[model samples]
Target: MGKATGFMEYQRLQEASEAPQSRKKHYKEFVMHLDDAQAKTQAARCMDCGIPFCNNGCPVNNIIPDWNDLVYNGKLREALDTLHSTNNFPEFTGRICPAPCEAACTLGIIKDAVGIKSIEHYIIDKGWENGWVTPQPAAVSTGKKVAVVGSGPAGLAAAQQLARAGHAVTVFEKNDRAGGLLRYGIPDFKLDKNLIDQRVKQMEGEGVVFRTGVLVGKDFPAGITNWAKETVSPETLQKEFDAVIIAGGAETPRDLPVPGRELKGVHFAMEFLPQQNKVNAGDKVKDQISAAGKHVVVIGGGDTGSDCVGTSNRHGAKAVTQFELLPQPPEQENKPLVWPYWPTKLRTSSSHEEGCERDWSVATKRLEGSKGKVEKLIACRVEWKDGRMQEVPDSEFEVKADLVLLAMGFVSPVQPVLDAFGVDRDARGNARATTDGAGCYKTNADKVFAAGDMRRGQSLVVWAIREGRQCAREVDAFLMGESVLPR
Candidate 1:
């Protein structure tokens, strides 16, 4: 931890965010970072808890206390190494993760939690600036070959780990670029694509082969299973690679079945979000969906929905409204009861603070339209009882909606890819695989493993990286007698 009395002596300080009015003008990151002195003071607030729960709170189980101490002691490089030891992409998590580690902070019981995320943000950024982040390619090759599908954080983490374990690793991405959803789903304002490019370049230098836009099933020969539509087949992958890890994200979106659902103005949040990311990356997109000069109504109150609101504001929408079917949560949580666990309190993202009318306890009944395009959203307030939702009487309302974006979250990974590989699926429609000591990450298919969103359903980037790293260990062990890689 930090100074013994640091927790009481120093208060938590966070990076300032650009005002909503200013940020709404552009689709660029608006959060300001704390200077070294400010970050050091924040790090000093980490108390020496007997058993640090922040480590458990983090999906990747990062060495939180050690880094906080390191930063407090001005040992920046060691802190970065400890950070990278557990997290392959601290930069990504630092930017986007909700920071459950903060909630689990012992000091957070009475005061603001240690600026764990901000400290992480500081360390990685400093590491990059000082050129401390360099590829350490394995000294000797084990002559083993491994293939990872989907080039998201999970796949990248796994590929990097396996490659570092002296295995020849190749990552196959269906997209035109690496970084899977990191390159597509996330908005550039949250994560700059250049950061992804920078890490990708390092991975390349580490001897990890990346093949983009070569659909495994379609472009490559039919390998394992040919269920992949835009990528190589499972059979082909099996033939070329000694072991295969399916790390694709959950691609299928949960849909709302209602009248006029097919209206032209209505689209999945993914469809609307990715185009903007592509445009930001300097790609030419024809007829891009623009909320500019139009009323925008985003459905489903979640991270994706919040993203929609932020994007709509950037698009200069006339009005933006977000609807959530569930009842609103309390503004604060009961720490005594929910300590060391993620609490179900109302959480607002920066996107929400930017500007938008957010309403919970409401349900969408239908999409009213004209000319095959949504014109309005007809909804009603709802009441919940006995685990069911009921519409409140006489509470029906109609909101002007020129464009409707559904961000209800994903239902499961696309079945086509899993089917093509003949991998068994769990009840949640995710690739069936256990993470226990015995069969961790092992798919039913021979020499096949699964991880990330495809294996665990939709989750945070930290979890994806954790699963990726762990799965790499499992794959290595399966390929060799055992693995030196940490689980």
Candidate 2:
């Protein structure tokens, strides 16, 4: 789809980054996007493979080849349009998505994959600079109304599509900001908050109404009150709107029930992340968690844990240690055995590079503390045997810890929220909703639907955007007897 001989002429080039020592001083984005020359060269790396597995590999199915060709030809505007055709917010995905498309690139079969994410970042940023990313309001109103619960990527995507389809769309968010995780959960160094604000402004011009600080259901867990100021029952939305979409994220964090769990200085990752984010946004955060001068121990080895590591370093923690339950994967994957599929391999994030002492196949036995405050963590090394974790004898140890952050990930959506809507849940506690069939995205309740993490469990932002777009199509069809929106 790009130059025929370009793949042989170019090598994959990553975006430049500021030194860790310098970037750790603040939370602003330190990674710079590719320039015009670099972006064009990177896009030229795309080859005309018989089949572009990269397309299917991407959850949103972005037209990678088409955009790559456009960028190589210096058609930056066209490239931006192609990128926006499938994904609503390339700015978010370009910065934070793991880029499964790059992993499945044809060039990756023999060499490094094309720099699709960086090119996307370049195109979107250029589009914004040129004032090309404007609102596309529907000309005719369908007179139907849609109430979307949540302001995360999924809810935002669905609301934008429905608004463009001539329906009045209202997004209800618990937080006082439009972007949910993008605004609160993620660190500012990885993604700037201004990008989200830009999208929210464009969506508003497109006729999407966003009501922040309005909870969609009741009995929200503790600490939720910090974000939500008012409540709107599911019945109110169902009564007022023609159709309702529940796209709330998975909020129930998995807990560590070890001894001294109730001690001070022990907290879930969400509690720690959102507070820093709020503080960055100029909001006064009372009793904000700080890793400064403290021995920080982050549990779990996924992105959440990595985020903890980065945030801790930014806070100038005395020391940062991360733990994982599973054995570490090989540094390099056997790509031939898992071509075009996401391979299990070691991934070192910028956060890890900042500074962290990481260990694998370890389990926390308990939290040791003094006088209602956490002081140390008791842990043991383990080995996997026949898919079961077996503790290694005489391997139990303890480490000093002034702060303990649990980044073990979430289990499901807040149950009471789903209960208020009378939506049936799956075995995993996710809202019961099918992505395909005659009645896709339809929940057990009439005129109600579910999508994204609330229905699919914890997943990437790309997957959430995909579900949100697909669910919008289903909702449009249900309301208008047919849908013009893309799946």
Which candidate leads in lDDT?
Answer: 2
Model 2 ranges with Cα > 4 A deviation: 223-226
Residue 479's lDDT in candidate 2? 98
Error of 1 at 71 (Å): 0.5
- Residue pairs with backbone atoms closer than 3 Å in model 2 (clashes): none
lDDT of 2 by residue, 1-487 (tens): 6689899998989899999999999999999999999998998889999799999999999999999999999988899999999999999999999999988988898998889899888889899999999999999999999999998999999999999999999999989998888888889999899999999999999999999988877758863333778899888899999999999888788999988899999999999999888889899988889999999999999998999999999999999999999999999999999988999999999999989999999999999888899999999999999999999999999999999999998999888889999999999999999976899999999899999999999999999999999999999999999999999
Q: What stretches of model 1 exceed 4 Å from their correct place?
A: 218-230
Model 1, C-alpha of 346: deviation from truth (Å): 1.7
Q: Report each candidate's C-alpha RMSD, comma-separated, in the order given.
A: 2.9, 0.9
Worst 10 residues of 1 by lDDT: 220-229
1-487: candidate 1 lDDT, tens digit per residue? 6688999998888788889888889888887667889988998898988889999999899999999999989999999999999999998999999999998988898888899999999899999999999997999999999999889989999999999999999999887789888888888888888889999999989999998875654332211111223556789889888999999888788888988898989988888888888788788988999999999999999988998999999989898999999999999999999987888899888888888999999899999887788899999999999999998999999999999998999888767778888999989999999999687999999889999998999998999999999999999999898999998
Model 2 weakest 10-residue run by lDDT: 219-228
Choose the strongest candidate by TM-score.
2
